[model samples]
Target: MRTLTELLTITKNGRGRLVLVSAEEFFRLKSRDRRAVQPAELSDAELDLIAKAGMPVECAALDAEMKGYAL
Candidate 1:
């Protein structure tokens, strides 16, 4: 079980090969399904930075057909 930072480190370069989701997206998915495979927890600092960067995160990228699964 790696932390969010660790997971980010692993996926950072493979961004084109992996999904990069925001913390909000992660939680919204989680609430919809108890079994949803939400992304790792991001630090508040990171979240704040993202918000400050003027990029509003949208979970709309999530596939509706994609069911919940453990990460």
Candidate 2:
């Protein structure tokens, strides 16, 4: 028998009970009810900044990674 660690999907039944299955089986069932995922777009100002900087300039005030940066 397969263990819980080996299972990728655990869904609740009608009585709210848990069900376990392999990733392959989960995807096969998910394909029938799949939806498209969309990405968020950057604003015109953000795009211009990226173009001018030749890359992304993340400031400490705006990003978590640069939180400890002096400037």
Candidate 3:
């Protein structure tokens, strides 16, 4: 089996280096996070801040379109 480092694709961007991984690997890494927080447990201020935050216009448009494909 290939090492994680060997399987990754690294690229340079203006901000910093970005690492690309397969969607399977991405979800595998995400699932390993044991410190996930419940939104309901957040304070009112935190919840308000989250609710007030806006997605980028491009992302908002894409999100609207993606709603149609949701299971």
Candidate 4:
């Protein structure tokens, strides 16, 4: 059980990918049958950065995984 305040605190610390979501959206996600909120689709630029960081294979795998859940 994560409170909205804790979510905000984690985002502020730059610990994870941050997404701007409405309160309604947040609660809806919380009550979903699947508790995990899927990761956002990565942009070309972000993918390029990941590749440059020496993780081309990892980035490709991540892209493939995200394809399964199109937001």
Best by TM-score: 3
- lDDT score, candidate 2: 0.63
Model 1, span 1-71: residue lDDT tens:
54443323235564545655567667767788755333357677866886788423575456454668656
Runs off by more than 4 Å, candidate 4:
1-16, 33-71
Residue 45, candidate 2: Cα error in Å is 38
Would you list the C-alpha lDDT of every candidate in the order shown? 0.58, 0.63, 0.75, 0.63
lDDT of 4 by residue, 1-71 (tens): 65543444235555765675659667877887655333356677876886787655747767766776858
Stretches of candidate 3 exceeding 4 Å from the true structure: 1-34, 64-67
How displaced is residue 36 in candidate 3, in Å? 1.2
Residue-level lDDT tens digits of model 3 in 9-61: 46567544767766777888899987858998889999999989988877766
Q: lDDT: which candidate is best? A: 3
The reply for model 2, stretches above 4 Å from the true place, is: 2-16, 34-71
What does candidate 2's lDDT look like per residue over 1-71, in tens digits? 77534654444563535667777767777889956443346677866886787434644445776678998
Give, for candidate 1, the lowest lDDT window spanning 10 residues: 2-11
Candidate 2, residue 39: lDDT? 31
- Candidate closer to the true structure by TM-score (higher is better), 2 or 4: 2
